[model samples]
Target: MGRLTWIGIMVALAAGFSAGAVFGPVLMPRPGAASNPNLIDLSALPDELREKHRNEDFLRNEATNYAHMQEALAQRAAERAARAPLDLPNGMESVPFGLVYKPGGDVHWPEGMTGELGDALEAAKDGWVILNYWASWCGPCVHELPEMGKAAPLYADRGITLIAVNTDPMRKDTPDSARALFASKGIESLAPYVAEGTAVDQMMAAADMTMANVSLPTNIIYAPGGTPYAVFEGGNLSDSPVWTAPQTLAFLDVLAKGE
Candidate 1:
């Protein structure tokens, strides 16, 4: 069978494995299920089965998840490569969500954004920038924040930077508060930058977007050379994107490279 066919089979099997996690393996600090929602409750198993299969099941489930994720990534990458755009002004252009390609130009940040958040954006102008907006009150933002932090490191290797800016309105919005929140959430790898002072309206204006078109959990994407776009806006926990997922990394790699 061809490689794509093999990947398809593996993905299907992974779905089955994930569904059968109770009969499969993996555990977490949580009393019952594994940290990954995909895996089932380990503590619920019979005492002997839990003891006998704890390590083995964990290893098996992790290995399978990783392998399946990679296979899916490679298969999708192949399909994406086959459909890459041909025309470009400077021999290249911005591709957003692989949905549309446009002239890749320098993005202009609004003047009001003038601190750590602005500095972070300025420093990463040479590559892809993923600006994620989140507020403490927004349930969906809290759900996806940790996943984004976990994926931040992987993004650096692919020339992408994920800047998760907190817009929590209740607090004074200090650096220490931001760092504290990240620590509380177990997000150590990514920077602790809050954008409370920097209004969402400022960002929307910079991207030429209107309030009618935007909502909470707005993720503003900046293509290489600094073209800006907003997407993945207005979603609840059910719609949250797991940034650490392999498919996410692969899609990012494709977007970051403009390939």
Candidate 2:
């Protein structure tokens, strides 16, 4: 099958997997829980203690919900692994991958460096490239930012570069918010790129990927010469096991050694 066609299939499968696993009945609130106005019996508690009790309950509920989600995600990942191995396009083993940077788009670096998207990618073509597409609005994307930050230096030592592209629209999702998030998450090592206009759309289209169809926190792994090797989409706990830092590093190691 053609590359785009294969990507379409993968997208469909990922959507189905998410629907079955992440957004299944487990996520539904208990019957009457949402409808009941007095679910919390705080009427007898003192005013000073009521807020504390509510906060404690909120934290407890959050922890439980997060655990359930993680379990579901892990199960989905295992099911995906049992079904098929991650395979790229045929003959892509030799194809040189490179970024199709959209000219006139602004890209910002942590060190206060600013430049066009194409120039930055061209300058960093000497090593394995992990092009991560993210947005501030995506919870999973925000959660993975810190992990990506922590892994960047280690990957850089092994001749790998991690470029985080903020796909938030300039008008609604300001660059300031992106920068703030990077700083808040302590993302020191990963360079940040801001997408302008249809820059992200153009880049994905060139690589036979579509943002609308794929999940957020999408990542494109490119070999040293810029040839795209793998496209991993969805949350960190996604069925695509390559979403983890270890898996990503292992994949990069294989590419770096030409294995």
Candidate 3:
């Protein structure tokens, strides 16, 4: 055979081998689950381009799960909402006290203090004293003050004394505003006083150290002997779920009739 003829035969053989190898995978794309054009139509890509996009969707999903950006954003929003300000008292800017419950109806008063309030607290008598620490700018105090005003008169004959302490930290406009607000609202029953100088700080310190850290609108109950019965550190009287209608009546009952 001529040399050119041999070379042509070899070339022809190589072409046939290449055609079979290419068609082998095309005939069977791994058997199970036939590729549906409507589902994942990849007819548009050449062989080299097809594999790149084959895992594109899977990679995108993996990246999303890895970052979890959407979930992080949602959590951040919730935190911000929770941190939003509540109506604080004038000259103050924090929720220093938390809710606390005392069992068995006993109150522990500050040692070495003796006065009307001190006497009432120590006696554990049926009568109850409510020490309300508030400020002019506090929204929660404003909301609760009216309820207290009404309740005070209603229970006046029952020996329930409502003392309102203004914890404005300074004799600024805040305390003045608070007093005016109370007067205008006809809160005549409250024994109002400005807790200026060190009084406010002292009370807060006492609460934190001895009385279970309390705040404005704090309702502390005592037995006749000056022992703490219960303490309610919450928002407006209407908003605090700690005292129910029946509980309120019961508390009043103890105050009015207990000795």
Candidate 4:
């Protein structure tokens, strides 16, 4: 199968895993009732105090609900595990809920890093501009790193500029650690930036949910006008077809031609 085709599969499976995790709550945190210091024993309280204790108990129950939900989810997962293998595609593992990809949102470029990257994009006299959002911790992102690096220089020679927009907030909080990780991984094409003092949720809400996921290696190709032309929503670059698929090169060619 072609690399793009594999990516398509990954996208589907990732979506499925996300759905299951959400509806199933397999990875929820179990907060035992004892963990909540504010939990009240209504039986020991007087009439007036009982009412107040009931309110506290209500809040405590909400907290414990997560724990109870987690326990239920664990039982379900164990039962499923005893059955056949998880039919998920290669290079994909189940992720927590609320991390699936949805589309139609705008890309959130950090204001500080936007100047250089945007300027680079605008400077493209001809050909398309490819902006890749990636992070080191992302598995798929790591897999795509080398190919993207190669593609960047190749596109540059063709008058197209491929700029990797690093969205890892760790760069701000731990510059040394972040830089070391990037350098160790040989991610030279990615320009690191820290999105500080900005709300990622707001930007993502304004942008497409299809672009966001719990997985790594989310890539979006933009045209010269800063509009999205194509998107590889999920899947790691190291997976089947990504390393050798001609379709990968074909898309790069399309970008080179500015189509």
Global lDDT of each model? 0.57, 0.53, 0.47, 0.44
Candidates in order, TM-scores: namely 0.52, 0.52, 0.47, 0.50
Lowest summed lDDT window (length 10), candidate 4: 1-10
Write model 2 residue lDDT over 1-259, tens digit each, in one string. Answer: 0011112322343332222222122232355575443343445656764444445444455455555555555654453344322443333332212112221112222122245566777777766777777776667677667777877787777787778877652235566777787888788777666766677566555434454333355566666666655655555533232323464466566666776
* C-alpha lDDT of residue 77 in model 1: 49
Candidate 2: what lDDT? 0.53
Which residue pairs come into collision in candidate 1? none
lDDT of 3 by residue, 1-259 (tens): 0000001121232232222222112322444767743244345657754553355454354455434433444553353344323232233332223333452222344343344434533443445665665666556666767667766665555676656666553345345676688888887766556655444556555443212122345455555544565555545434543222344545565555752
Error of 1 at 194 (Å): 1.7
* Candidate ordering by TM-score (highest first): 2, 1, 4, 3
Write down the lDDT that model 4 would get: 0.44
- The alpha-carbon root-mean-square deviation between model 3 and the true structure, to one decimal in Å, is 27.5
What TM-score would you give candidate 4 relative to the actual structure?
Answer: 0.50
Every candidate's CA RMSD: 15.8, 13.2, 27.5, 12.7
lDDT of 1 by residue, 166-221 (tens): 65433455678767778899998788777554465566455434333223455666
TM-score of 1: 0.52
lDDT of 3 at 223: 51
Please give me the total number of clashing residue pairs in predicted model 1.
Answer: 0
